[model samples]
Target: MLVKLGPLDAGRVADLRPYLDLVPDPRARRGRWYSLTAVLLICACAAVWGARSLDELAEWAERAPDTLLTAVGVRRHPLRWRRAPSRTTIGRVLGAVDGDALDREVGAYLADLHDASARAVSGQRRVIAVDGKALRGSARLTAARRHLCAVTHHRAVTLAQAEVGAKTNETAHFQPLLEPLDLDGALVTFDALHSVQANVAWLVETKKAHYISVIKANQPTAHRQLAALPWRDIAVQHTTASTGHDRRESRSIKTCGTADELGGIAFPYACLAIRVHRRRRQSVRRESRETV
Candidate 1:
């Protein structure tokens, strides 16, 4: 399995050096002109800008700077570099390429990059957020909505993705989606839906990863145990405030160890129970308050 780097799009500095050589050439030598690697690289590079259709991808490649074209290995003819491949060519070649191979190689490269980044940051384990969402623009294709569960890095690189079954929910697909990645010693966070005992144990015992799970009404026993804690007796231990485009928000956190009065908040392998209160005031238009 190839442990790969993160996204290669703009604003995120990724090492695209190894990407060009990760996959083998799948085209015939008889009529090949453009480098297959260059085309694939262009598609990846353009992804962050939301390009997807063949026409849009090809257009982005054509407008690419000379430096990028040369770096991804666009052919340099005797007189000049050949133009980026056309939309028709891009469609044909990409259709013939091996998606599974590309995914593995990219995953390997991203994993390697994550490991190196960790070393530079004093060995702090990376954070992998596992979540799922409906595939936008696909509601018209299938009878049931197409949903996919995926794991992503703190830096926004996707490690893996798996389609959620029509007969099941995202929680059921969580373990399978994360089974393929190299997540040893990483910190995983998921919404309340995946805060089940089986999933948490699988992550710890099988994937060798730690998790920070949020408890809500989904798990009645745990939720009741946490909500019934003596929060009135505990002082707010930490507070974080942020100011953004049109809003100012603050969160005050109160944490209580499970060693003393609340020893029965049994959610499997948990040692602490925390509560967060959030207050948001958005300009002069809106305001809200919530807690978890």
Candidate 2:
């Protein structure tokens, strides 16, 4: 149950409840009294209200008022009693349901929600962020922590995700994580660790996508070449300054089109290079400056 945690978005619930019905029911109808959709909705509500575990979920359902249980479609007892499904029942249903089918249904719902916003605007590519995160609540069950690489929309709606091998880092799992997404002409952004030729090449040549990645010491040559650009000769194109909480911060940036002056940086599809200088100041004239 990959639920979005926050104050429950009533609109989101309404939009997604119908999609939940598409998840196939694993139980036979003759003996099954509980609706699978209702169970998922109850779990969704539990997550929204900050329940973190099975015990907590059961406790929440037991404590919930009759109105709340009924609102999420919990079945009424035949004698007109208020009732909710037990944690054991929730666990069995979720454990038995086809996870892939559930993900597909949810993905379809998300795509509908994203259609208006994720569309390309005047040929400008929409952004998708790729990153890995440690799965919460997995440590108790495994010797190694489970980590996942996810492709998400700019609004943080997860489009596709896959578990990375415990022995491997996110780099090796990048292609698989992104291949399922519709990335043509989209701009994908990732961190320095994923800035490699193979990734950029596949995105550009195979997927017809654009990418933005950080150049750090991990890619020594590109970092050195980009770092050696004639940044001092270029004027700052943008600048911003703000002061708050007894601290002051300022940043200025310079960008220049790549050309022969950069000595033809040996990087694929080299384009513009940018430099940003930042300064932070605390009390009593203490200051720190860094450039990247």
Candidate 3:
């Protein structure tokens, strides 16, 4: 099922006031022409509308109607006819704002939204995905390239993010991205890069949550052990099949029993060693009995 989020209303914009209010204004009061809240609201709205730079945000604000400005808490200017801030002012203010504080506030706001939505649709499991991405336009030869993020699977909302430094990778920053979240009853997922003993321990033991991580060749011992499991002998196996575009595919997944043959680097509370196999066939075959 797909849930479509509607357009943002005045009430929803007002909900962000408390969080944006926490961002300190670094500008001097004497020459301050616009309210900090108004500028932030404008930037946030512009960002939602796909504005990636300060100039684009300023252009969006310039073209915005008075109703949008007023709805976002922009008050009348004392001397000027317009209440919107210039692109330069927006850039300066944002540059001077504390990044860590802004991240926490935004993360908290998204978490609140997630919790409220989850309550509205009770009994459904929430899946949060952790991954890393590079800033497309901000790449530099000497600087680190990627930023780690924790996002929800369904709504694609980013709950938290941390920059991956030059010397460190996504693995080092994974735990910090998840530290502020309330993960109770949520199933977190990560790729093989994060499929380590520490992350599994934290998810299952410390947070009391469930997880599904890829077991890849990077973890040689775990991958080898899981691959050697007797999947055919397993009592319960799940199978799924699909056919489309002149091709047919089927997959079967099974879990191993609780035997100590795996090894000493055991995952905390680990009960299942899963293996999946996939087979595919095409509708058209060569005359020599070779399937393509």
Best by TM-score: 3
For candidate 3, the 10 contiguous residues with the lowest summed lDDT are: 283-292
Candidate 1 C-alpha lDDT tens digits along 35-69: 77778777777665668688888889889888777
Clashing pairs in 2: none
RMSD of each: 4.7, 4.1, 4.8
Ranking by lDDT: 1, 2, 3
User: Model 3 Cα displacement at 256 (Å)?
Assistant: 4.0
| Residues forming the 10-long window of minimal summed lDDT in candidate 2 | 1-10
For candidate 1, give the lDDT of residue 64: 84
lDDT of 3 by residue, 155-273 (tens): 88777778777777888887777888888888888888898888788887777789877777787876766666655567647878888877788777776664565542345555666
| lDDT for 259 (candidate 3) | 56
Error of 2 at 185 (Å): 3.8
lDDT of 2 by residue, 68-183 (tens): 66766777888998778888988888789888677767766765555545554555457788898877776765466678787776667777667788678899988876775667
Off by over 4 Å in 1: 1-35, 46-52, 60-84, 141-145, 242-248, 260-264, 280-288
lDDT of 3 at 88: 88
Deviation from native of the Cα of residue 140 in model 3, angstroms: 2.6
